[model samples]
Target chain A: METFADSLDTPSVVVDLDLVRANIRRFQAYADANGFKVRPHIKTHKLPLIADMQIAAGAIGITCQKVSEAEAMVAGSSAITDVLITYNIVGAEKLARLAALARKVRLSVVADSADVVDGLSRTFAGEASPLRVLVECDTGANRCGVASPEDAAALARRIAVAPGLAFGGLMTYPPAGGEAAVQDFMSKAKALIEAEGLTVPVITSGGTPTMMHAAEAPVVTEYRPGTYVYNDRSLVMRGACGWDDCALTVLATVVSVPAANRAIIDAGSKALTSDLLGLTGYGHVLGRDDLAIDQLSEEHGRLVSTGPIGLKVGDRLRIVPNHACVVTNMVDEVYLIEAGQPAPRKVPVAARGRIR
Target chain B: METFADSLDTPSVVVDLDLVRANIRRFQAYADANGFKVRPHIKTHKLPLIADMQIAAGAIGITCQKVSEAEAMVAGSSAITDVLITYNIVGAEKLARLAALARKVRLSVVADSADVVDGLSRTFAGEASPLRVLVECDTGANRCGVASPEDAAALARRIAVAPGLAFGGLMTYPPAGGEAAVQDFMSKAKALIEAEGLTVPVITSGGTPTMMHAAEAPVVTEYRPGTYVYNDRSLVMRGACGWDDCALTVLATVVSVPAANRAIIDAGSKALTSDLLGLTGYGHVLGRDDLAIDQLSEEHGRLVSTGPIGLKVGDRLRIVPNHACVVTNMVDEVYLIEAGQPAPRKVPVAARGRIR
Candidate 1:
């Protein structure tokens, strides 16, 4: 009766807030020990409650990817003063929004070019205050940012002299190649930016895969790792975090035991997002690695198990999704479970669907 | 400002309701000519307005994938009197919910076993009315359902005799390879069910791909195609609909022209829902087919083109996401465009985050 196993309601997202708090503490401790500032990315959790917890755990600030996400967080807590938007702010309207946000908090953003620099300059010109800007370096991701240190330095110089703008430093998302390359690139960029007579004080770089190694690298002044708070199947596959370290789990109900080897859960792609991301399957069933959640309908998760899982109809199972960040955006609320508790505290995912 | 090209927001879901209406009319016309009831699945749009439009245009009822979706739709309108859930109803809790839903509307569900039948029977035995059930056949998408026609017929027989249960008919999600085989099996199963003196009224079969072909197939009395209303990149790839027929698009801003050939948009896995389903990339840029949206960060979409796209800062583009259903789940509201206009009537995706 206490379990949600008997419920037939499909396409709902379930969260364990207790696990989220533990994750926050763990990541905070890691950052504290490494002498790097912890700036938890709100892009992963998207909940204001989770963001508050991260800040409460002694995080320097929150890292947001969108202006809307930043706006949502600002609405939740004016106390969260320092926020770094880890995305390129281009376009007139977006820069205007960014400029407005900058007026409220200690706002900083990443950029990769002169056009982006010009866009920000035009939007923030003649303002009483200015927006902090970081020149994004490619760092082998080959996706965004300047490919070379020279390009980064060139942008940094423009940012240093641009009206209503301050050059914060350099930023990059290292592609799983590791710390040596990122450190090398950051060092060259920092030297180049300083050579251009601008202070590159805040060097930021860290992804879930590079978190452990990022602490060992000295050039990065701040590390922002989001997924360490919710170690998913993808993070586990990459050896980023242990299964025990995974704090977020999708609670689902077994709605059908159609075949001896096959069972179906009410939670599907709609609940646990079908983002396999090169993984073998949709998600990993907690405590049952042998069971494969092989197929996902939008509302029904097709679970196939060769072993005796002793799973029956109406049994509630917790699933660790392949990617947790995308899953956070799909729901409006989440539950925070305290230790040894029957009921978790209900908290609204206030920023859940702020996709703009 | 008239064209969607001038929108201010990035990663926005733009639906051409005109195209959606046209698709609905086309499907309704096909179903009317072919003598099959059109039960348009609400899983595609997750919009009650669209579902109501389909019903107004001659849909007999509607198909809901999730209990929450069905509950929301039923709550929204009194005109939608009948709903057929195209999923297995399992577990005591879900059965009770299903029973409660049956009280308000003529509810029908699909199942593949005696356990589910027994669960439904037990839950609805004392109710004023009985629950209608359909035995799901493993037509082609070997994801779920009974493997043999004999098993399906036996399950149907059990539903007929069980208290508070009525055997409706057979249902199948037609996979590409086994349409003919499924037709042969369903024909035999229909005969077997009829021989048992049971009313097998609703023989439902068809997905978006085989929807047209299913109408001509033997023993398919109803067609339930979800994605025809909003043709996606995947559907276009399958040749079910052309690019012009695509009703759904994700409007995004070009956030970064990082390199000459590569640009990054503010939309990524969060906006596009990383449900690749074996397509080459996340989405197809409206005017640039050669530009492949090959990489996705949580909030950044990396577009790779052979040459410079002539894209600059402040440029907005519409992208047809690889999958529309998953995209709908990511946003709180969507704009209903008449002719791809920037200022379109905004429609709330009412059940946007109703996962469970």
Candidate 2:
């Protein structure tokens, strides 16, 4: 029998629905048993259908990285009533959109600096409901957020006193293998915030690699895991999830068998993405561990064989890309593969290109 | 007076229409003077409006990488009559789409293997007009193409004798400094094919780095240059075009100034892309040679300064990415900056995700 995956075109994203639900239930069950709220990041699978599935499986809310992404999720389904934008919201246009989205849903934003908080204050000063704000602590990520617990406390105090803003808590996206540091950082920040006569209702820390050990940080009230819904090669390499748990795979055809050792596929950087994530090569070809995607142009993926390979043109292969979040943003539609279905149903990546 | 670019959102693609026209005319003029046909690759801009502009400036046709992309261009505008898909067409779905598109326009495709040609021949066998096919030859890129002149001749002969196929000629995407080898390979292939009583009408060779030296190869009758329309940092590094010749820039906002020398922008891999292309960092921060975009997540670009920088929160910066072709594919829309316009006109990237 021809499966739904077999009927799709080359260079398409095929998501196994069974694996998606299983991954979601497993993560949600872990979070539930650990007394932590699960706010799944929608950036991994930028689809409302998947977000709805996450919410139905006992998620507190959905975490988005951009205002437009939050808006797309809210517009796609009413189940996403609570949204936490994890990026520093800046500029008048984005602030206005943020304010409008806050009016429609329980919206909260993160800010590492006072300028971002000031912008939020000016945008929502006279609104009926004050906007919730979280001070982002660095927690060893060294990317965004305040450096020390003192800075986090100061930013939280600033957000507390800002007009039409409520200091929600502290949030951090720690680096991989920095769970111990995150625990120490968040504990110190929580103590500092409590010393200032403020209650830290929520201390959220997240990273796919450190998600399993999230409970090790006693101060964290919630965990936001994005890649768990659709595990990728990066997650597999980090030992966060096994290879069999990967729900998403890019279906591609070997368009050209140029030589005995080199086969080119239709998927390229535009499909699989160029986010190496400190890994060598591009992606892992399923059922062909010997073949490595050595190179990629915009529209062609070069798969090189480690040994003699019997691949030919027109042969189809599925690849687990290094990073699934960036790949989700690359395509407008993805195929949903369900067991016993005649064909995979096409779902619009509703939040794709919503990188405002 | 604020310019159109100043009034728009951050992390958006701002294309200077004047520079786009100038770049198109400059390359077309060079190709015209040197007796080479100009078939601008639509994968760079992916907009029918830009494709129409290239055709108006004297391009013989447009080159596409996928069947869906060609379909989008042909459906968007009537100016794109001739489309040369430089990738091999495979599968029943894509072959049917290729046959349908061939009926609408002057369509031709390239194949490096017998399987691809056989699929194309099977799809177009009973059609009124035979589909044109070109044998893609490997001139040293070693990505996708026939191995040698002998293989190229054999594929050309197979394509010529196929039921509903016409041998167009030879095509290649030569490596950046491989002009001499391309000349040698194409000349020998042309002679071999001619010995079999087949006319090599179009010997198409292209690459932005080797575009200026394309005329050095006497056998190449046509050139397809994609990134020349919006020159990037890679092109600048190769001495193909100057920094001032670059027409595309990603307008990003400094969302947070965490430290004295560290600034974070709202654009990341989703905007700038992760195509290092053998260069360090993500992109060239325009006007700030002292700053480097050292890291990128999905929505955050980390700019670390080599010295004391004057940039602050909410300040905007323009970046010239390393690869313009991949960056263009990441966005759904781009702002067109025309002279004297109060607001930059927004145009949908008509063929953004047509990776079928």
Docking quality (DockQ) of candidate 1: 0.63
Per-residue CA lDDT of model 2 for A132-188, tens digit only, reads 999998887788899999999999999999999999999999987787888899999
- Predictions' DockQ, in order: 0.63, 0.83
User: Which one wins on DockQ?
Assistant: 2
Q: lDDT tens digits, residues A310-351, model 1?
A: 678767778889998877777776655555656555567777
Docking class of 2: high
TM-score of chain B of 1: 0.96
True contacts kept of each: 0.72, 0.83
lDDT of 1: 0.81
Worst 10 residues of 1 chain B by lDDT: B1-10
Each prediction's whole-model lDDT (CA): 0.81, 0.90
Provide TM-scores for the models: 0.95, 0.98
Poorest lDDT segment (10 consecutive residues) of candidate 1 chain A? A1-10
Candidate 2 lDDT over B1-356, as tens digits, reads 12764688888998999899999998888888899999989989999999999999999999999999999999999998999999999898988888899889999999998898999899999899999999999998989999999999999999999999999999999998778998999999999999989999999999888787888997899999999999999888878888788999999999888788888899999999998888898999888888888999889999998677678898988899999988889898999987787788899999998888
Residue B76, model 1: Cα distance from true site in angstroms: 2.5
